[model samples]
Target: MELIESYNSISESDLLIIEEKIGYQLPVEYKLFLLQHNGGRPVLDGVRYENEHFDFVGHFYAIRGEMYHDDLLRQIEEYKDMIPKGYLPIGESPGGDVFCISLKEPTEGALFHWDHEQANYDGEPWEYNMTKLSPSLTVFLEELCVGE
Candidate 1:
């Protein structure tokens, strides 16, 4: 996938610090991606899943940057309670939906789309709000297509 407007490159150590703070190890390919691209807008921004659902990625959150809205750490903290455990918000859609990665087993490394409108913040099970997007971040990037 092609990415543009990426932030300043970050070191593996920076990722390690984030992992420690988040209390979960990031997937291997995702870690490499952060080191190389940090975060940026994908040229082929459209993502499709569940046969018909579609959305365009706005921007991926970055690790080393002054853009607070696009800061990975800040996004994580902001969505901690909103997002269910065992997942981490890494980016967003223009309409405020979040893209997250599964951090625990049985679904580790998997990517998901979290629909904010359908989210449950009242301690109800959130499985209904999460739609599996891809088996892993690697596949997710490869599958991104140009939006019409």
Candidate 2:
């Protein structure tokens, strides 16, 4: 996927701090993407959720963007309990649902979507609450297509 508009690059030191604060090693492919384009829209529009498709990837949070909603670190903490354990918020649909990366064994680096309407923040993630977007971030980018 291509970044349409993005912020400046993040230094390795800053990235390290982010990792430390978040307690997970950032995916390498994602780190490369961040170094080139901290946050922005993918050229390919909407992403598919199960059989339903929505505005692909409207926006991603920058490592240190001025906007609260577009701030990566901020979103991480805000959505911490909203998402399953080890999942990191990376982007979102135009409707405000979240796209995240699985940080656990077996699904590490895989992309997932948390439906705002279906999720239960107080409970464990159920199949009804989550959809596997792609096996990996690379594959997710590859599957992206223009929105309606």
Candidate 3:
């Protein structure tokens, strides 16, 4: 995946380090993937960063995206089954108090989640589900700096 930069701030070497940790070469094409698919939030310059880490309705990220394996989807399912009803099934980071997300049903989409009454931003709409997802997300994220 090609990386979108916030100003020429991040170097190839820095991305390489991230790649080394993730063990998958980020295809050059994926930079657009991060921008279009991930997020569009700007930093100091007009540049923006889209992390695969935390993207919940609230909270700032200590780390972005998760490093996980293929099995995590199943794990999320198992975790979902454990949800106590009424409350959302959320994943917590071992690092600190972070934004948590809900366990989505298979029919939902991977949008940035927000409660119905909460404020909305001018971005992609989110849903309250992720159950019908492909498995690579877990592995793709597991190599990144995510925690939960």
Candidate 4:
């Protein structure tokens, strides 16, 4: 993906701290991505899940920043309850839906599209609201496209 207007650079320590705070190890590919581009808007922002399912990315949250809306750790804290366990909110869709990465086994490193409107407020079985987007962040980045 072609990203632009990325935030400040980050180091391994910054990622380590985030991992410690979140209590989950980030996918290696995603960590590499943060080091290269802490946060940014993708030029080819469109993503297609199937023949008719499509969405556009707004922006990726920065690892460290003064911008409240773009702060990764802050966003996680603010939405911790809403987000299902074992998933981390990594970015947002243009319409406010969340793009998350699985942190638990079997699905770790996989990316998912969380539909806010259909989210389950009740609990754990909330996996229904998440649609698998890619097997890994690496594949997800490679699949970004220009929307029509």
Candidate 5:
């Protein structure tokens, strides 16, 4: 789980691509993941290692399901000071209001998925594998112009 820089580098076009893919505009923080990625893979919390079994990239897309999510969301905001430096905070999902974040490519959406059916004390990072990418989402992202 290699913790890359915050997504401050994700381009505006790229951000839009993401929003279009997921069917929603991303919170400012989620947009960061796109930018700071710096052409490398993104990792969890702060770990980075190779996972041959999976793409590690695009592993997660469009997360769903959760419990006591509001409290966790509040906790993240309340304890923002406690969070380590370099740890970027994505935002709560509009559909389910669930906390959502994603891994950069190569880990496309890895860190967020590896562990499922359990809360990660961090909004339960989730993944949507490449194979599972929704046709609509694929079309949306594919068609949307990153505008270079």
Candidate 6:
């Protein structure tokens, strides 16, 4: 994961605050990643999804930021109604698709892609939309290839 731009590493207190605000304990690996790289674009990034290469992961959002565009906490609140409850936005694709993690029990910490076009307002996010990207954020990063 070659970061194009990164923010300052956050302290443990910040992480705790975020967990409290989000109402769920973040996955250990993801919390560590955020501590190292608060937010940034990944260079030459591509991940395999259903046998197809998706190079659309443009940016990972910061926990909170002066720049409204990079504020993950705000983004999560903004998209709360649009996405299923307990799902939080962690990153975005170049085409504006959202990448999230399910906070619901039994499926907590699972990575998912929330496709706008395929969304169903009345149904659960995982029903006919929201593709599972990886079992965990750690695996997702590990599988992301630094493209040529």
* Candidate achieving the largest lDDT: 1
Window of ten residues with lowest summed lDDT in model 5:
129-138
The lDDT values for all models are 0.88, 0.81, 0.29, 0.87, 0.31, 0.79
lDDT score, candidate 4: 0.87
- Name model 3 segments beyond 4 Å from true: 1-8, 32-148
Over 19-67, each residue of candidate 4 has an lDDT whose tens digit, in order, gives 8988878878889989999989999998888855489889998887536
**TM-score for each predicted model, relative to the true structure:** 0.92, 0.88, 0.24, 0.92, 0.27, 0.86
Q: Write the per-residue lDDT of candidate 6 for residues 1-148, one digit (tens) a residue.
A: 6787877779889989988987878777778889989978887577678868854788998866635787788888777777887777888887778888877777788888888777776655544567888888878887787542
Q: Please, what are the lDDT tens digits per residue for candidate 5 over residues 1-148?
A: 3433222243577556545654555545444433544223234212122312322232222222123332223334443443332222333212222222323334233113222223334552333311222122222223322111
Model 6's lDDT to the true fold?
A: 0.79
Give RMSD to native, each candidate. Answer: 1.7, 2.1, 14.1, 1.6, 14.9, 2.3
> Once superposed on the true structure, which residue ranges of model 5 sit more than 4 Å away at CA?
1-10, 38-99, 102-148
Residue 21 CA displacement from its true place in model 6, Å: 2.4
Rank by TM-score, highest first. 1, 4, 2, 6, 5, 3
Once fitted onto the true fold, the runs of candidate 6 whose alpha carbons sit more than 4 angstroms away are 121-126, 146-148
Q: Give candidate 4 regions above 4 Å deviation.
A: 122-125
In model 1, the Cα lDDT at residue 107 comes to 90
Q: How many clashes does each candidate structure show, in the order listed?
A: 0, 3, 20, 0, 23, 0
Q: Which lDDT value does model 2 have at 87? A: 82
